[model samples]
Structures are given as structure tokens and as C-alpha cells.
Target: MSKRPINQLSLFTPGLDTDPAVKATMREAARSCALSREQLCDRMNELAGQAGIRLNGGNAKQLTLATLEKWLNPLDREHIPSARAIGVFCRAVGSVEPLQTLVAPHGLYLIDEQQVRKLRMAEIEEEMEALKREKQRLKAGS
Candidate 1:
């Protein structure tokens, strides 16, 4: 398979608005790593449109990292993505250099489905505890 450029793929990343710092980091990664900007933009435009992300609002030529936090993540925002996210955005998901340069530096810790499951379980546990506490308080009052 022919390798697509970095700039092309990075643009499609969901947080065109949410994660600007990461976006700026991605742009720098593209330039330093020699990724294609135009192709990335094209792919980004296509995917973002499907996901209902506005493409033509702010910072036209470049993505602004600061504005990223305002919008909701396309899917789930709680846990950061793992290989799945990389598979969706990166040209090389498993490559060490890519992870070190493109993802890790930006504080995006990749989490697998197992990690997500654990987090969900933890959240459930917390909710259960809260409910139990509320029940105890009601019993005491009664």
C-alpha cells in the first residue's frame, strides 16, 4: 500500500476544534516528519463533515488548539483513544517513531477497550457507593 502523507491524515482527527495544542503539535509533527498538508486537510474535511464538525468557522488555514476544549468529542470524551484512534487518524498506528513523535508528546495516552471497561466499572462502583450512602442517610432520618 502506498503511504499517505501525515498532514492529510492528521487533519481528519476529530478535535479540529477541541484539541488545538495537540493540533499545533500535530502540524509541527507533519512538517518535521514530512507529512502532506493538503491530503490531510481533504481527509479531515470529509470525515469532519460526516461527524458534523464545522470545517469553515475559525482559523481557516491552520487548526487552533485552544478552541478544542469547547466542543464535545465525536464519540466518547472520557478516555483518550488507543490503537483504535491511531488507526483512525495516523498513517502508521503501530510505528514507534510515529507514536513518540505524533501522539505521546501531546499527552494523549492511548487506552484499549480493556482500559475503557475498567474505567466504566469504576464509574459504576462509584455510583453504587453514592446510592448506598443516600439510602443509609434516608434510613437514619426515618
Candidate 2:
């Protein structure tokens, strides 16, 4: 029997827009994250009202619908918002979806507050169990 080269197989198709797998994954992420375009816009608008952010060389206390529409439009990929803007949106909405979407392709994940709390609790429980076992072992040896 002869072995086939790995490169001979088709690993990935080039066009993401036309690829069913890519589309399905995107749709699934959006659904699981429960983030709609309207909700995103509303969150962005709410964040824009705060005193710190500046957009396009002007102090925008609030972002206008026109600006937000341009940013949110699927056809306007070239004009998509910056990473900082996405971060602000995530913080404003209390959701990690935007950050996860941005970093997923790079093999990264964004941990939320609830996940952190759970992880910490697990660690504490494990440590307590270990301490109890060690105490028992020392008493037996004595």
C-alpha cells in the first residue's frame, strides 16, 4: 500500500462568504451569544454617551444612528469598528461574544466573570481536599 500526501486533500475552501461551514459557525455563535444587530447598536449607543470616548477626531457624547449603521453593516467590512470599540461594546453589554468572535480565529478565548468565579471555587475546593488528606496522613504517621 502507498501513502497519500496530506497536501493532496482539500483542507479549506477560500471563499468564506460562500462556504456553508463558515456561515453555520457564524450563525451558531451569534445565536448562542444571543447578540442581535439591534442589541449591539443599542449597547454601542449607550456606551457612546459616556464622557471618555472620541470618534473620528470629534468628541461624540453619543453616537448617531447613521454612524452606527455604517459600522454595523455587513457589506461594510472594510469600515468595521476597531478592536477597542469592540472591547467597549462587550463591556457595555456585559457579554464576551464580540471579543470571542474577534479572537476565535486566532485560537483564543475570552473568559467571563461567571466562568472565573466557577474556576476559582473549584480550585479552592481541590486545595481544601488536599489539605484534609495531608492532615490525615500526618496523624497516621504520628
Candidate 3:
């Protein structure tokens, strides 16, 4: 019986390489998405609204296609999306590549729930092997 959702693995992509070009990553993520730029912006704004997200100076404004274009533009470094916007964008695009790229340079990596369970299972196996070794040592001493 698991307390967490069984489908959490869908949220993460393990073993993905890092890319330092955040703007390029974002651009690629958006470009590869099934939604058009206008549709993507619409989806981003919809998600932001549902989550009560506000950008820039905290005013309630919907994300515009022009703003998204600026963020996607490599030369327009000044208009990088906010963390909230990034979250919304990732959700809207159905890909975490942009977020993963941002975190990779910081020595952080994303792992799925299945990977975490596998690691824990391996650790427990190691502990069991250590106990077996101790049992053998005890029998020899007896």
C-alpha cells in the first residue's frame, strides 16, 4: 500500500542531460509542443489563473504571446520568465526540459518516484547482506 500517488513518475524525467542554454531550452520546449504559441500562452494563463499566479510586479495580468516570445528570444535576456511563469509554462508544454536545464547547472538532478523506490530497495538489500555477514561471523565465533 503506497501513501503517494502511483503515477508520480510521470512528473519527472530521470537521466536527462543538462543544457546551460535556458533560453534555448525554453524555446525548444515551446517549439516542440503541440500547441501554437498563442495556444501555449492561453494554456499558461489558464493554469496561472487556476493557481492564482501573478507575474512581474504582482499585478493580475494574463500572459501574452508577445511576452512569451520575448522570454523565448535568446537576445531578450531581460525578459526571462519568472519561476511561477516557468512552472506554468512547463505544465502547459507537458515537458520539464526547461526546469531541468535550470537545475542541472546547480548540481541538482530530478528523479522519479520509481527511481527513489529502487534506490531504497537497493539500500535495504545492502543492509540485509551486512546482517548475513554478521550472522556468519557470530556462528563462527560460537
Candidate 4:
């Protein structure tokens, strides 16, 4: 597939209020990171380059420290980062907390490979309980 600009504006409603917690999560992620903010942006850009991704407007630079600052700034809602930027930020900082924070308000969550099995087991247990209840109901009716 052909490469597309990563920062295309989609799903944004003008004048809509955004959750402050999203930016707070990003700030916490940055604070917990061992690398400085400049280093973090550099690493994000490097990763984007490796993935053959570029920001919108076909700009060669994927991210910069100033851009990153705007993203983390609570007052600068207009400078929101793209989904791709968030992904790279998570990868660079070695945490999914920001992503988790974004999805939590929607009743969604992120789970790692290790948690998949546990989730499946819980599902299976629920199904078994449902079946047992059905069997008892049938026996009583018979």
C-alpha cells in the first residue's frame, strides 16, 4: 500500500471538549520516562522514520520537541498529537498508560499477551456457568 500522511485530521469535532485526563496521562508517562523530552521526541521520530511514516503535509520531520511540548500542554488542545504519534510515544517510553487512559473513558482497555489467556478463561467460565443454569432449568421443566 502507498504511504499516507500520519497526521491527517479525522474524527475531530470542532469545539468539542476533550478530557483533561488524556493529557495528564501523557504528562505522567513523560515524567516517568528516563529519557529527557528532547530525547523522547528524537526517539519517536526515529521510530516513525524506521516505519516509513511521516506527519501530515508531507513534512520530513515526524516530531519535534516543540510539538511534543504542545501535545503535553493542557492549554494547547489545538496541537493534539495524532494516533501514530501516541503509538510511537508509548513505544519510546515503554508504557501503554496513555493509550489506556484514552480508552478507559469509553469502557475499553488494552491487554497484553499474558493477559489474553486470563481473559479467555474468564469468558469460558462464564459460558460454563450459563450452560449449567440452562441444564438445571431443563431438568426442572422435564
How many pairs in model 3 have backbone atoms within 3 A of each other, for residues 3 or more apart or on separate chains, i.e. clashes? 0
The true-versus-predicted C-alpha distance at residue 68 of model 1, in Å, is 30
Worst 10 residues of 2 by lDDT: 13-22
- The global C-alpha lDDT for each of the candidates, from Candidate 1 onward, is 0.46, 0.56, 0.78, 0.76
User: Which residue segments of model 1 deviate by more than 4 Å?
Assistant: 1-107
**CA error at residue 82 for candidate 3, angstroms:** 1.3
Write down the TM-score of every candidate: 0.33, 0.52, 0.77, 0.73
True lDDT of residue 34, candidate 2: 58
lDDT for predicted candidate 4 compared with the true structure: 0.76
Using TM-score, give the best candidate's number.
3
- Weakest ten-residue segment in model 3 by summed lDDT: 11-20
Residue 1, model 4, lDDT = 100
lDDT preference between candidates 2 and 4, better one: 4
Give the alpha carbon lDDT tens digit for every residue of 79-137 in model 1: 23233232333442222333444454334555768999999999999999999999999
Candidate 2 per-residue lDDT over residues 34-86, each given as its tens digit:
55656755666666556366433357555555665555455554445555565
Clashing residue pairs found in predicted model 2: none
Q: Please give the distance, in angstroms, between residue 22's alpha carbon in candidate 4 and its true position after superposition.
A: 1.9
- Ranking the candidates on TM-score from highest down gives 3, 4, 2, 1
The C-alpha local distance difference test score for the whole of candidate 1 amounts to 0.46
Best by lDDT: 3
